[model samples]
Target chain A: MKALRYLALSIAAVLFLVPFYLVVRNGLVSEAEISAASWTFLPSSVRWENFAELFSDPAVPLVRSMVNSLVVAVLQTLGQLLLCSLAGYGLARIPYRYSGVMFYFVVATLMIPAAVTFVPTFVVVSTLGWVSDLRGLVIPGLFSGFTAFLFRQYFLNFPRELEEAARIDGLGHWGTFWRVVVPNSRGFFAALGVIAFVTSWNQFLWPLVIAQDQESWTVQVALSTFLTAQSINVHELFLAAAVSITPLVIVFVAMQRWLVRGVAETGIKE
Target chain B: MSHARAFWLFVGPFAAGLLVFVYVPIGWSVLLSFFDARNTVTPVEFVGLRNYADMLTDGPFLRSLGTFSVFAAFIVPLTFVLALVLALLVSQISFMQAFFRSVFFLPTACSYVVASLVWKLSVFNGLRSGLANTVLSWFGADPVAWTVSTSPPWYWLVLVTLRLWLQLGFYMILFIAGLQRIPPVLYEAAALDGARSWQAFRFVTLPQLRTTSVAVLLLLLIGAYQAFDEFYNVLGTDRGYPPFARPPLIYLYYTALGSGGQDFGHGSAGAVILTVLIVGVTLLQGRVVRR
Candidate 1:
């Protein structure tokens, strides 16, 4: 039984890992080698120059898109963290009129699937003159209802004494949040931040539609153009795929603990 | 600051963003659904449910919903079983738990576009050099055109496997958390009552996992309905999108945005219809699960 278990695991693990390995292997090889009828498990020669070739290609804007993706993801993460955290804290802790109505409104957004609003949201962004601009890419996605919901759920469980102590020490609500609440909830913030950042980075249809011009494309949008471009370079495409996945892999490796924890919290909750 | 002031100060921006970006668009979409808005958001003519009627009766659009049903029917159960089985298996092992967990989860970091590229160009590509064909050649079998052939509909294999690789691990993590919450004492009690391991699992573990299972199924259902990236990336070609597997989003996108005509009325109508379907299904499923 134990042996069978290990075999199942090892097989699934290999299946999961093969595509990643292929991306790396094909990335560093020549185009002829990639298209060769006889398959090779490894590249004969490492072509580090594919990176340079990819970046230098006029049609493929690798560096600019990567920068755009980074900027968009970072700004989106920070925006979600600040806006959702504040909203969540208020919903959980503050006593005020219209609290129920406000909370209901936020939660209702979660039920309205993205497909329903895809075109109209595009219309909204376009009407605002954000089409083909980073603002189009960043602003619409800045405040997620799901993120706020998660934060509100997390804050409801927070110890009241911490805020009370901060209050007694002469911290106002804003001061208490910035000084005490924010500092204490680093893990939750990091977990949600990782989610928001990865989501923004991996976003496809929105970026594909909104960033119409080549200059404003995200890495995902850029990688897509490779497939449909006039000239397809298999090796360079693989290399580009490899390059695109690098930042996310790094983030996942570094922040996986918090991510797992965050997943757990969401799963077991009512 | 006073409590009222603090509440507004904190939640105000989020509420405003939600109203502008979410609720208003929904209202606009509903309004657009009733108008003769073609190639423009502002319409001089109001059509009054003609758009909604057109979408409901449109063969391709309705078939797109059927495609969603097929996708959801396959993916929801497959992912649930695989993820649950993986969670059970991973939780049983003591050594290198974290390694196995991370190995499975690492793919969650990958984007659908990147994965689709790899799958299309190398893995499932129709050439003899493609990974699947290469393996088949070794086995003395003919190479199959995965994405191209619609008779056998081999594209489903490409689509489903890609989604499985990208998503299975994340759900496994959810099940793992659910598994961890199951008390070992329950298993002990079952064992003391002379129940076998399978029986213990059926009674103790499965019942304990009800909450997580429901949540996972709900999420998987919603996700299956929302799928677009892999379909657009993998099946798409210079010729055009194949008719067999275009989900509602792709259909709506082509109607409203992809085509130069920009038939916003029909698209908005389809969107509203799809939204109602999704919410209705979700609510129905919730009721069923509760029962």
Candidate 2:
């Protein structure tokens, strides 16, 4: 029975590992080796030069897209963290008359489907002459109601004594937030940051529409241009995908503990 | 500062961003749906209900919805079953649990676009050299035209497998969380009665996971309706995607932006319709699931 369990698990594990294997193995081989009408489960020889070719290909510079993705990801993450945390703190902590109404409104916005906003958001961006620009790609997504809701939920459980202590020390709302609340909430902040960064970095459709210019394309958008029937080469495409997802894979492996917690906190509530 | 002043100061940035980006666009979408708009928001003609009427009558848009319905039907159940099985299996194991959990979830971290492309041109590529075809070769089967063959929809095998591979891990974790919340004592009680494995699962595990299963199923249904990235990334070309591969979102995008012409009026109407479907289904499902 124990052996049977292990065998079942091993089968499941192998099924899951196929894609990872294809990415790593096929990525390291040449185009001829991949398209030879025979399955090569293992690479004959590691040809790391496919990635070099991908990077140096003037059509879609993998390096430029990575940097572009980094800029968007970092700015958007920082922006959401700052903005959502402020709103969440205000809605959660401040003794304002309208906080309850405001909190309800903010959380209610979370239910609005992304499809409704897709076109009009584009209209607004194009009207603002933000087409093919970083502002167009990054700004519209800088604040999310769901992220703010997570922060609000977290802050509600935060110890009130910290705020009172800050008040005793002559700290105002902003001061209390910066000095006391933030100092103790590094785990939540890291979770939010990692989640926000991964999301922004991996965003495909929004970037695909907004960043059509080669100079402005995010990594996923750049990787997508290779899928056009003419340019579709499995070897380079796999290498590019392997390259594009490497950072996220690294981030996931490193902070998966917190990432899982963040996903749970957001998902189970819904 | 006073309460009102501090409140505004704290919430000002988020409120400004949300109003300008989120609220205004949504409000504008409603108004845009009424007019004969094009690439620009400047409505070319005042055509109230015509845009809506046109889409309602359009065969392609309706077909796209049907296609998406099939996708949703297949995906929601497939993911629910697969995620639950993996979760149940993982939950029982004690060794290297976190390692296995992360391995399953690692794909969820992968971008959908990347995953889809990898599945299409690499694994399920129509060529005999493709992984799926190569695997079949050993079974004395032939290479399959996956994306191109809409007659029997070999593309569905591509779509469903990629979607499952991409999404199963995340939902599995949710199920695991749900599974853990089922206290061990219930199982002990079941064991006390000498209940068999199937009986224990049926009595103890199934009933306890009701809320999580509903949440999982509901989320999967909603997500299936929003399908675009995979279909577009995998099946689409520089010109356009095949009819069979088009979901409502992809269909609407092409209607709005395809070189045929940018018909934001019709597109926004479709968007409005899609939004209504999402909200209505969510409300209906939430009521059902919660009750």
- Which number leads on TM-score? 1
lDDT of each residue in B160-198, candidate 1, tens digit only: 989999999999999998888888899889999999999
Q: State in Å the error of residue B246, model 1.
A: 0.4
Fraction of true contacts retained by every candidate, in order, equals 0.74, 0.60
Interface RMSD of each: 1.4, 1.6
What tens-digit string does per-residue lDDT give for candidate 1 at A1-270?
A: 988888899999999999999999888898888889777777788888887887888877888999999999999999989999999999988899899999998887777776557888987787889999988898889778888888999889888899999999999989998999999999999888888888889989999889998899999988887775525688888888889999999988889898888777655446
lDDT of 2 by residue, B1-291 (tens): 787888999887898888888777777777888998876776677888998898899788899989888998889989999899889888888887776788788887788888887787778878898888888998999889987887787888888999999889889989998988999999999999999999999999999998888878877877888788888887888776776668888898788867688888888888888877776877787688667
Off by over 4 Å in 2: none
TM-score of each: 0.98, 0.96
CAPRI-style quality class for the chain A–B interface of candidate 2: medium
Whole-model lDDT values for every prediction:
0.87, 0.84
What DockQ, between 0 and 1, does each candidate earn? 0.74, 0.67
